[model samples]
Target chain A: MTSQLFSHDVQHTLDIAGIFVFALSGGLLAVRKNLDIFGIAMLAEATGLGGGVLRDLIIGAVPPAAFTDIGYFITPLAAAVVVFFLHPEVERINWTVQSLDALGLGLFAVTGTAKAHDYGLGAVASVALGVATAVGGGVIRDVLANEVPSLLRWDREIYAVPALAAAILVAVLIAAHALGPVTGTGAALVAFALRMLALRYGWR
Target chain B: MTSQLFSHDVQHTLDIAGIFVFALSGGLLAVRKNLDIFGIAMLAEATGLGGGVLRDLIIGAVPPAAFTDIGYFITPLAAAVVVFFLHPEVERINWTVQSLDALGLGLFAVTGTAKAHDYGLGAVASVALGVATAVGGGVIRDVLANEVPSLLRWDREIYAVPALAAAILVAVLIAAHALGPVTGTGAALVAFALRMLALRYGWR
Candidate 1:
């Protein structure tokens, strides 16, 4: 169970990347909702960091990394700007946005699970927190937009399930002392593939 | 500056009362939204404990009191049950509910501010967290119900302001070495009266 499979720098980079992708999705939603620039920025920040904030809080991490890291705080605003300028073009490329969102979900699920484990939570709680970290932001965004959370809707695609699967697999691998870059990648890939498959097949 | 003005038993009782009142509001909303029993219970719990959970997380308190204390966990469910059975009557007494809600808000704001101070946060942060603890649950509840949060709506009566006032007062009193049961009670009453006044006059 090597916790340092990826150096801190690499992990931080990936985290930011995930946040950016998630923020883009949130920003696009704000645009669709016809919210003003401030709303777009607000939603982007919430959607990008909500899950991580929730995870950090549950794990007793004070002043969450999202609040402390200037980079993390600014990435969502950058995503909002990009969306504000290119929303029409971005809307046309819905498939691409969704694919990246799936990638973000997978990455966050793995990372969140690992962090929970680092905080000494048991496997079940780690997996639950991982799923929350992956989907919580979207739930918050949808709620703020006065829409039912897609993750909680029966008719929606199987979003949380893939994240849950990834988290569980990661927890199991860690428990078996086989967790490393390969297994981590494997876990994320499994979740990403499942999400993509759900999109393609209209899985509910 | 005495943190022990109220005995632990009394404080616990007050906490449960606050949770009960908040949960009642959530449950009433669930009934109005035509949600099922499960939804009512879920919203009840969310409204009752969301703020405290959020506050605990920010202050690095693990497994917040909501998760650890059986009373906290059950009080919301009890409120849900009462609403499920007597919603028609509850709806008729809307004024009563609103008054109690104001009391809960004031109580939570004071307690939250004091707790934040206990956690060594400065005055500003403590006050901010106090307001969050007072209104965060209702925001979560409104969001889950797919409505613009009353706290964020410009047309609504002032809600957050009273909580903020109470929190600031509590923080100031604590800093001045003048904090005690009297000051705390006075702060809460000021907030409660302000809220009730806002309700009566439709203050936005």
Candidate 2:
């Protein structure tokens, strides 16, 4: 029971970290769009929780974890507050933001797939949800900002592709009865490397 | 049991009609935005179902009726096909579209509120979700087209306000144990008239 509890804590910690980075990116976008504090907070909350909310909703998880947990609810606001006060510094560290975003993407993609599988979805559906979980928040952010989502742009560098690969890896592992911590880590690492490489090469 | 079944059928039919009109508006927006055929279909689907999908997710309704019902899935595509072929005619009939949209909004707001009440959401949250069900699709449509949602624009005439009023009325009725077909229809009519008045008088 203690071992199980420890694993649960680790998962929760990772989930919160991913949400923070995603929220930071969202808050930064709100700043760039010249949105007021309310808008910044709204965008941050949406970006951090939108994907998971979507996933949970589709899987019949009511009230959503974000709504139930005060910590989850407040973390994105904290990110938004930081962006509101230090946007210029945030902008200056674009590389750091991008790196964090990549990490979030990798983590979400695998976790989303695993959760979908737990919910009894097929591999294809799980993969789709996984990608949605990874990128859905950004789509919501861009939409609220009245801009084309970078994910759907023809000229945008590869983003969803790497996430898709990670989701697929997790799904395949589950199918082969080989899903475990090592494989999950390997899947995330692969997606992270691909995202970083795409960023470095300006892959379109 | 038979009466309950009959009311359910009536509600279902009304919901489908609302979705059709909403989908038509989404398809028209895609055409105006110069998106391709695929984009048109996607936008149509998103606009038609986005609200209910969000509502269902929040209420813990799994798989979403939109995904489960074949008619719901196909209606938007059909609307997209029509818009693609007769966009000029659709443009010419913009007033008709607007009127239908108003009708759809009223119907959706009341139905959404009732559904939320059935799902055990409190009055305040139910009213919020009701407005969301009425306006969420259009917001998604605008966002995908890279435009500010007219519903959120300060200059735009009243849209969500009338829906909110209707939703509030439903909540009050539910609270008073007076919710019925008469009250529901009356609420919708009130909202519908308000919307039309706003359009005609250019209410800001």
**Best-matching candidate per TM-score:** 1
Model 1 C-alpha lDDT per residue in residues B21-40, reported as the tens digit of each score? 99999999888877766567
Task: Indicate which candidate wins on DockQ.
Answer: 2
CA deviation > 4 Å runs, candidate 1: A5-17, A30-46, A53-93, A120-129, A139-155, A158-204, B1-17, B20-24, B27-46, B53-110, B117-132, B143-204
TM-score of chain B of each: 0.97, 0.95
Residues B1-204, model 2: lDDT tens digits: 111312877888878888888999998887776666655776887899889888887776676777556677778879889898998998899898888889889988998888887888899999999999999999888878888789989899999999999999989988887788888888988889999999999998
DockQ for each model: 0.22, 0.23
Candidate 2: where are CA atoms >4 Å away?
Answer: A1-6, A35-42, A81-86, B1-45, B55-60, B66-139, B146-204
Q: What share of the true interface contacts does each candidate keep?
A: 0.38, 0.38
Q: List, residue by residue over A1-204, the lDDT tens digit for candidate 1.
A: 344856788779989989999999899989989998999999999999999998888888768999999999999999999999999988899899999899889989999999888877777667767888998899888887778776645566788889989999998988998888888988998999999999999987
Cα-based TM-score, every candidate? 0.63, 0.62
TM-score of 2: 0.62
- Clashing pairs for model 2 are none
